[model samples]
Target: MSGEERGKRAARNEDLFRQVNERLHDLAVISGSSEPHGKFVCECEQTSCSLLVELSAGEYGAVRANDTRFLVFPEPWHTSPEVEAVVERHDRYWVVEKRGTAGAEAEDLAERGSNLL
Candidate 1:
């Protein structure tokens, strides 16, 4: 293909990647048992309800979000009284928020992982 065509193809690929990312963010991680990490299953406040998605270290173990984009503010940030108040009220969230790079790594690990655990 011509150089112009190649550049256009790369641009198209970037655009496609962005679109796919947008769609991925739209999804909620399903909650269940934490086998490899731990035996206990996460029981967010919504357990009594129909929601099954757990509070995982999404985005490692800093700010948490559940099945519906419902967010959990993990530590460091959790040090703040505001975050602490939420935790005190909810009393279910275990893990605290991780740093940005770690969060991205956790996401990658989850993507590479399986449910066999």
Candidate 2:
């Protein structure tokens, strides 16, 4: 696939993962789970990735503060340098901000209400 196509695909995959995490958060709220941390799937470009990262609600909220930002594992393989940059790094997870075409795509998805909680 072309570079732009690859970026778009990555954005879509990450957005989907973000949606899942949003649902998980909503469930936590509904269930009144006072747990300090939640398990969220890694928002990486790799389709086969099933790595889960644990984060506090505040930490996840920080990552979701930006439409183009995503939560991923801190490992290097979890990041796509071609389409994103690591904006924040924590002990358990890294926040990646999509750039260029991928960023536009992520913003578009967010605007479409895909992140509704």
For candidate 2, give the lDDT: 0.91
Superposed model 2: Cα runs more than 4 Å off: 115-117
Q: Give the TM-score of candidate 2.
A: 0.94
TM-score of 1: 0.24
Question: lDDT by residue for model 1 over 64-114, one digit each (tens)?
Answer: 232111232232332222111232223333332222333333344335432
> lDDT per residue, candidate 2, 1-117, as tens digits?
999999888998888899999988889878988889988999999999999999998888988999999999899999999999999999989899999999999999888876544
Off by over 4 Å in 1: 1-89, 114-117
What local lDDT does model 1 show for residue 107? 43
